[model samples]
Target chain A: MVIKMNPYIEYGKKAFAKNLVYRSDYIIGVFNTVIMVFIQVAIWRAIYGSNTQINGVPFSYVATSFVLSICFAAALTANDFVLADKVLYGSITTELLKPISINLCIMADTIGNNLFKLIMQFAPAVIISGLFLGLLPPASVLMLLLCVFSLIFGFLIVYYISYIIQACSFWFTNVWSLSVIKNSVISILSGTLIPLWFLPDWLAAAIKWTPFDVIYFAPIQIYLGQMNTQEIIFTFAKQIVWVLLFAVLGMFIYKKGIKKLCIAGG
Target chain B: MRKLFEPFSFYFQHSKMLTKTRMQYKLDAFLCCIAVFVRESAGIVGVFLVLQTFNNIGGWNMQELFFLFSIIFLTYSFLVFLFSGIRDFSNIVNNGEFDKYLLRPRSVLLQIISANSDYFAAIGHGTLGLVLFIISANSIGTDWSFANILYLIITIIGGVLIQASIWLLFSCSSFFLIKTDSLKDFLYWNTRKFAGYPLSVFPGFIQKLLMFVIPFAFVNYFPAQYFLHKPDLAN
Candidate 1:
């Protein structure tokens, strides 16, 4: 008998090659996002001017947050989402019949997709924000490493959450609307559109316990040295917990949804 | 004698489609209204918070500034609702979808404008932007001269044209290049920022770039300054 390797490594390489071809578009995407940051900052600057404060955040902080928000949104972009699309199009039936565990395949596709975004969207947004807005203060190596690890976990959580939404298409074709609603809420709660600090108090408080913040907000803040060690530790812990929670939920939903899938041959 | 009814009938036919689209998802339509209600109301609240921090910006008191903000949002919301499909032009062109538009009997611009009319979300935030503008303007105690009102309309309509033109330009490029998702995102972010605030804060060079190159000032700032009586803004 001959042993075969997982197809994920091949899939990831193909994704990277695809990204290389469309690289200009990705750069422009980051550039436009930076432009948005400028516009947002300009608006807030017009609003704040010389004011000292609003809702407990300094005017400068608000301006800074405006810039950071764009960066974080870019960093967490979930570009690759083959599992959900595969599942919807009945491609997953073929994929599932393979010897590789369904979980590993999903993880591979997501990691490959997100890794491209991580560099193209996330890195550039940070560099641009730092250059125009303010430099992110340096932090301890330990804190930085923890932030990266936590962010990886957070990305997985985001993938799982998105997959769960995609899974709903197993039952309904009109998942786009629900997905839009989910995206808007997640973008807000994840501190992508606006930081949790600037949001309405209730909205901010409602999602505090979730891992969404840990994904973008926590890591970036850690990079900027905004959070103290204990806070960093606590946030990363929360993030890991949510990743576990979502992963479990994803497995359950996929199992249930697989039964509902109507393959033409079967 | 028979050629006169095109644009008018176009608008009417638009209203008919708008009504049906609104009816298609009654619950969604209602929820969208709620979302816009909450979002715009929060914006108004944010505007108010900013006002509290300052007595007047560039000699426009809070009420007048709010009036300006409202007008800007109103123009933006309207265009985004109606002309937003043009923003996707780049992608359409890239995919050779524009070939279909060129083949259509209707005017290309008209078809494009009507192509992706998000009537629900458009009406949602659009109505909100309009009401807020009216409330803010009325509260400001400015007597609207007939000429000033005409200028206000021109500024907004012209501003919409300017923004829509930019979108159209980008969309057309998609005929030359297919993946416009990146450009579309960039344009939206840039537009949202421009729409959200007055243009005076930036340095002269930056302002010139936005005014002459982008001409975004036509949307709200110049018009607002006219009513607010900013010293340097042109007629």
Candidate 2:
């Protein structure tokens, strides 16, 4: 069982350390969710021209939603399967026989990375977004706490989802394509490319059931008080369900995948 | 004439050899094509999303973005096709693969650059440039004076050289730092990602930093703004 720590520390450490080693490797990625915040902010600002509300989201709330989603996504971003890499490259075999679990070990690797990425990816952008486009202060203190809970569950679901995808690489030679598909799905379904708020009503309803929305959108909505008590509870429950589902699924696949792992020289 | 044609023959010869080995696996080419398509299409998807968001990016629309993309694509295509040998520099330097290049009879950079330049690689750039050209003409309405078009062409050529030099600088670092291969990933990622969007969308500081500090702006955004008659972020 993974030891329970403050996930804020757990994830914050992951983000920080990743930035240290690959500090030089600051690369661009699938605009996931925040790109829309900027794009829409520009497009909508041109549309609303200092309006109080659109689709029940005040301009301030809308701005906050975008920043929240982007920072959350970055904070949760991992090295994308360092564990599978260890397995494919024969490094996992040696590490597996070590006392630590590969899953925890890989998670540990991303601790500082998550923090680093936030600084690199989120910091400057936040400052810029705030200066040009201000965000909403939440309606109450209670909402902030709820947002925190939703975000933690959202992160657990995010990392677990990556683990599931990476774990499958044991069975497949080319997980790159699958990794691309994973992010692409996140881009469209998770509200990375566009805000879930702006998605067609039917598409938004359909995506709510999938794990992708739970990654970033769910937390942002929950935090913004856009979700009611019942909806938040349901969303949290769905996130846990996906986490349990993916974790169980990951272990089963790893069992078969380990047998398939051919350490070339060994 | 002999000196001029020697490099051409060298590229053709090695590429022929490379193709023979590559074609031996008939599906490799097809698979590579699919990967390229997915990667490019993802960018196109984002571009589509942006077009949906705004009719104008600083008074320039989708076609203007394509016009900019075309210049970058065409120049990058020619560079990657001819200078692809440099792609292996970091790897080669790390693995001590340079000894073989040194033992050969021609210039090191020239041989290395052309050693891997092949037709399929050329075609990858060809497809992107063609697509961007079509879209640029379609979106921008293609009204330009002869002088304006010529200046745009000149700037693009200069832009390609700047990008090529940066790639070379990253590769050369391997000569001193074998682990510089890690930096290659950084360079490729940042440039590809940042170059895709209009620099103005980023804040003023970023516009200045990337343009001046890294100078990646020259590759696409600066020239795009110039051609499309848009304002500079610095201004």
Candidate 3:
């Protein structure tokens, strides 16, 4: 019996194998994640000194938020230049000639890389840091499952947004500044740098209108049981809407960018 | 004196050429500066929001915290301006470009140091640091006497040297390891992040790590204490 293999899966495996070559990154990544978590937790501890609860939120919630957010940030390692590099280095022609979808290939590569990170870096760092710094138990098993479900959508939202930015390279030729700006905006507005609770009410409300919060904070809230059944459903729906929105936007840009693509060298 | 100054002249000539090449893409350069400024400003905004929520962290208020961050930013900008080559040494080694330096008549270290600089990062970070320094220095009410100003200058110079030496040490490791990026990120960047906050905010071991292991405490925290005179630093 003959078997057919998926090209996208092969691309994913290739990406996964590529990361294996950097063995030391796996080790240092754990320490990096731990130290980053520690720094934020220490700062938060100093902020909450001598106070068990501030504004009806306990200290453990903030600690858990940092631990989860940093871990997710570390694991959600989508390379912002994956598509841009191809376009810049004149490799996009070859990528386009391939029968497989370039977008799917990029998505597979990202998923593969993140899968390695999740198992190799994220699990260990989460376990180690969660032990050193206490973590609140998940709202429940059902909530934990739903949080993971929502997190997948969060990853898609981030990935599609990055794709849209990378697509700009056809016009600009260098998207580094745009990527930096995107990362800064995301980190600040998404509650990755500071919990949204601490943000002024106006700023927090402004953030809600954007898709940034669904990336990290929404999953966190679901895990912490901060959301009720209705709220959880609403949040998940919002996440799906963002993923679809960004995906459509990314496709539009990629189409226009490809139409105008220019390669100077053979 | 001419013999002694030869390398300095060479460095200036090399840097001048590099700056000219960088300026060819003026818009990219300007955008990069703004990108870095915005990136760094996010952290400051985070701190500001935190302080707004909680009036003070470990007895260091907003202005004092901004002053502490400004010191690190200014010193780091200088370090990047002078020693970005060392900061990116692993790439040079991995790409087999280090041999070109060895072939030169001048010192390998001098070639490495003078070969490249990141003026964009320097400008971006320097602008932020200067703005924060001006605002915080005015509000924090530092006497800014001759001695105090001189002390600040000395402290900045010391910080640049301390941080540059740390980068040099890691860059040297690239000769053997061939990839010290993650190691540098762990030892240098992560510790630098910790240094942004007051040393008293961390645990005892972290404080010790900052003081003895990396000495980043001296980079910003101790100098900040000299000016702010926080109660925690009395010991």
Candidate 4:
């Protein structure tokens, strides 16, 4: 019997295998996550000194939020430079010539890297931090399932956003700055650095309109049971909408960028 | 003394050429500066937002917190500008560039340290640090006496050395290990993030760890206390 793997999957597998070669990186990645989790928890503990909750949110809730947010952030490591590097080195022309979809190949490669991170980095970090920091149980098994579903959507949202940014490489000399700015914006608005609950009411309200929150905060809310059933459904809808919006925008820019792309040499 | 000064002269020439090359891409250089500025400011914003909601953390007010962070940013600017070569030493080693340096006449450390500099990070972090310093220095009511100014300058220099030494130590591991980037991230980057806030807020063990194991507390927390005189300084 002959079983042929999809080319996209093969690319993804290659990326996954590439990451595994760096053994020390995986070990240190887990420690990095643990330290980050500890720092966040420590800072929160400082803020919550002698008080059980602030603004109606419990200390445990904040702790749980950090654990989930940090782990998800670690696992959501989509290679923002995958396409940018190809475009820069003029290899993208050869990529285009291949019968396989370049977009799928990028996505598959990112998924492969992310899958490795999820297993190697995210799982261990979450377990260690969850044990050390004491994560709150999910609101329900149903909520847990929904959180997982929402997280997949969040990953897609992040991937598409990075894709949109990298697509600008065709016009720009490099997308490094664009990617950095995108990361800063996402980190702040997505509740990865600090939960939106701590933000001023006006700022929090404004952030609600952006796609950033759907990336991390929405899923945390789903798991924490901070949202009611109506709100959960609404948040899921927002995540899906943002994913679709970004995917379409990314494709549109990619098409425009392909037209603008001019390789000087082989 | 002349022999000692030779590497310094060489470093200046190397960095000068590197700067000129980088300046040719004016827009990219400008955007890189803005990118680092914005990226760093996000953490400051997080701290600001948190302080706004809570009013204070572990006896440190917003102004004191900003002062602490300013120290970190300022010292880090200098550290990255001068020691980026050390920070990226493992890459040089992996790329087999270190072997070329070993064959050179000048000191290997000097050649490595003078090889590259990140002017963009220096500009970006320097600007943000200076902005934060001016704002916090004015509002924090620190008596800017001559001695206090001297202490600030000395502490910043000390902070940069302490941080650079840490980088050097981690990069040295590359000789024995295949990769040390993750270890550097775990030890240096992650520890530095913790140093952005007051060390007093952490648990007793974390405070001890930061003080003894990492010594990051001296980078900002303790020096800021010299001016702010926070209650937790005794601990």
Candidate 5:
């Protein structure tokens, strides 16, 4: 029997294989992530001093949220900087000459890199959290299943967001500032630094209206069973919507940027 | 006397060159300034949200916390802006930049630092810290007498020196370790993380580690405690 494979899948596999050669780099990356997780846990532990629950959320749950946050944060791509460099150096012209869509190539590469990191960094982080940090178990078996699905959707949303940011490099010689602003807003609004529950009611509500929460907070909420079944379904619906919306937005920007490139005779 | 001023003049010249090059991209530099402000302000925002949720953490109120945070921010950013080159010392060693620096008439340390002076980035962080410092001082009713002002300046200088010393130590490690990025990352992340909170929050051992082992506690924790009139208390 013969089998057919997608070339994008091949590109992803190549990326994964290429990363394996840099064992020391990824090991350092993992260690950095572990320290981050530990610091976050320690901070939360200090905050919960002598109180089992604050605002109806348990300390154990918060600890678990932080562990998951570190995991997802590690599962991020270098696409924005890579794309920016390619454009800045005029290497993007060569990339454009390829038969495949540059955006699709970016998406595949990001997915490949993130998948490798998720396995290499995230797995060790989870074990470390369980042994040292007193991480809470999922609320239920069903919740664990739902959490995985939510995380996959969350990854898609995050990927599209990165793509959109990378597209901005066409206009700016340096997207460092824009990237920094995006990161700051995401860290706050995504509940990675502190859970939305700890935020003021008005501010928390405002953040909930944005897609940032779906990337990190929603998956953790699902894992902790903080929401009812109805709320869980609603969360999944929102994440899917965000992923679709951002995917369209990213493609639109890429098309316009490419059109500009043609007009410039590049 | 000529030797003493040599480093200063070299730094001034290099910084001037860097400023001219950076000014070529005015809009990008301006955007980066805004970016630095927003990125650094995230920690303050997190502290604010935490304090707003609960009146205090580890017996320190919001105003005291702000005071602690602002001082660390001011000194850390100042150090980073002036000696940002130290952060990439490993790369310099690998790329033979250090060899070139050694051949120059000026001290290598001055050249390295002046080569990487990120003035615009510093402006963003320093401005935010200054704003936070004023607000915090007002809330805490700090008396700005000559002695108090002198003391604050001394403390800030001390903090900057301590931070620079830590980075220098890390840079030295690059001479021995083939891969120093992990060590560098650990030091950088831990100090930034620990400085953002009151030292009292951590377990006793970690507190001691920060206070004596790393002495990062001096960055903000010790100064804030002294000013807040908690000299008798030890976490």
Candidate 6:
């Protein structure tokens, strides 16, 4: 039997290819990410001066976690600005009439764009940090494979969160600051700026229950061998559950948003 | 005197109109303020987490670091509030609205900067910074002498000037590229992320780069150090 491919993945590929045309634009983006990562690593290094551990995780592990978190964030924060614009200016009307589901198309395109960014921006960043600043290697081959899957889950979690923010444009009409709030909250809660281990115990535990930790913290934990096999599976299960939940929530929001837009003649 | 007064009066008038427009969309304006506040608070939380982990980064404790962070944060909030038009310069230039500013009788720079003063977002960020400032000051037992106050005021104004010039330089590139928003975002926004931390945590070369090339060191690092009476490390 022949296998049928998802058409939305084709949109992802087209979106990926679209970015290749502007590959030059991302050179500075990679450079900026590298510099930012370097600055972060340096701060962590200073914090760990003459010391080996930060809240049970070694300094090196924490640095590696930061590297992964920063790169993942750079790669996965897909273009909500464009989505917001489409909603704001009534261009979403035509977008809704597309052959495939609008949300699927947008997510596919975002995934493609983020895939390109992962290769261009995130790959170089990891390489630079690995060479110069000492990014830690994945624990084992199995952990490496699991880490990659977790990163995909992480991306989906972020994508859903961003989708909700974009969908807010229907209700709020001018939800630009909502994006800023979303990003900042993600950066903190997802362990982009600081590892979950460093957060206050109660706060860390609280964040673990949210989808934010599944985005960066869980993968970083797996990469650092902080989680056992069963723990890794459980973490992955949690991420998958969050992804499904957010995906459903996103679709519901989109449906209601579209209805509101139609009724309001936006 | 009249020439100088004209710009201030124009800014005041434009700001009033902008505030009124913002009030028209009361819910959005309120939500935007809360959003900005949340973003700023998250940055503080990041700082709090890091300092909690390390106890002190370089020679600076959490209170001292918060002071440094607040200075940059408050100044940035002020810049965003007063000169939001400059931040949106690329949009204006790209959409041909810049031609309108150019055609105005007033100073083109003044007219451009006064176009969209984002008072609500500014207040949100600024209030966060002010709150942090008060917290840090109280925690550190900061000397509230007249001299210290004068120095703090001057240094803060200088920091604001540095930030404004950075924005102006990057935004001015829109004239040549006509699509400089991405570049501006990269340069202006990304670089500012490093401002909250102590410069001493960075390598010597990065320290030199921040001090000389970008002048971000002046934004908070050097000023906070001087304000706190720490020995100069730049020299």
- What is candidate 2's lDDT per residue for B1-235, written digit by digit as tens? 8989988788788778877886764554554544454555555665555456446555556777677666766777777766777766788888887899899889888878766754454566568777877767556644677987797678767876877787788889888877765555544544555465677666555566567866877877776766666755554
Give the per-residue lDDT of model 6 (tens digit) for A118-237.
888889888987788788778888888888899888888888888888887888777777888888888888888887778887887798678888888788888778788789888889
Across residues A102-169, which tens digit of lDDT does each residue of candidate 2 receive? 66666766666655656676665565655656866665788878777777777777777778778777
Give candidate 5 misplaced runs (Cα > 4 Å). Answer: A1-5, A76-78, A262-266, B1-4, B231-235
> Measured with DockQ on alpha carbons, how good is candidate 1?
0.25
DockQ score for model 3, please? 0.82
What is candidate 5's lDDT per residue for B1-235, written digit by digit as tens? Answer: 9988877888889888888998998898888889989988998888889888887777777788888888988997788788888877878887666788889786778778888877777888898889889888977867778888898899999999988888888887887775577666666655676576887777666677687767888888777776777543442
Error of 1 at A181 (Å): 3.0
Per-prediction interface RMSD? 4.7, 5.0, 1.0, 1.0, 1.5, 1.7
- Give Cα distance to truth, residue B33, candidate 4, Å: 0.5
Query: Deviation in angstroms for A53 in model 6?
Result: 2.7
Which CAPRI level is candidate 3? Answer: high
Those runs of model 2 whose alpha carbons end farther than 4 Å from true positions after fitting are A1-59, A95-139, A200-206, B20-32, B91-103, B115-129, B143-159, B173-188, B198-203, B206-235
Q: Which candidate has the top score in TM-score?
A: 3
Chain B TM-score, model 6, reads 0.91
What is the full ranking by DockQ, best candidate first? 3, 4, 6, 5, 1, 2
lDDT of each: 0.67, 0.66, 0.90, 0.88, 0.80, 0.81
Error of 1 at A21 (Å): 1.5
Scored on chain A only, each candidate's TM-score is 0.84, 0.81, 0.97, 0.96, 0.92, 0.91
Ranked candidates, highest TM-score first: 3, 4, 5, 6, 1, 2
lDDT tens per residue, model 5, A1-266: 43333878988898888889988888878777776777777877877879999999888788888888877787754556877777777788898887776666777788788889889888987788666878788889999899889988888887788778877777775788888888888888888888877989899788778898888888888888888989998999999999999999988887777666522334
Which pairs of residues collide in candidate 3?
A: none
Looking at candidate 4 chain B, the ten consecutive residues that score lowest on lDDT are: B226-235
- Judging by TM-score, tell me the better candidate of 1 and 6: 6
Weakest lDDT window of 10 consecutive positions for candidate 3 chain B: B226-235
Candidate order by lDDT, decreasing, is: 3, 4, 6, 5, 1, 2
Which residue window of length 10 is worst by lDDT in model 5 chain A? A257-266
DockQ of all candidate complexes:
0.25, 0.16, 0.82, 0.80, 0.71, 0.71
As for DockQ, the candidate ahead, 4 or 5, is 4
How well does chain B match by TM-score in each candidate? Answer: 0.81, 0.85, 0.96, 0.95, 0.92, 0.91
**Between 1 and 2, whose TM-score is larger?**
1
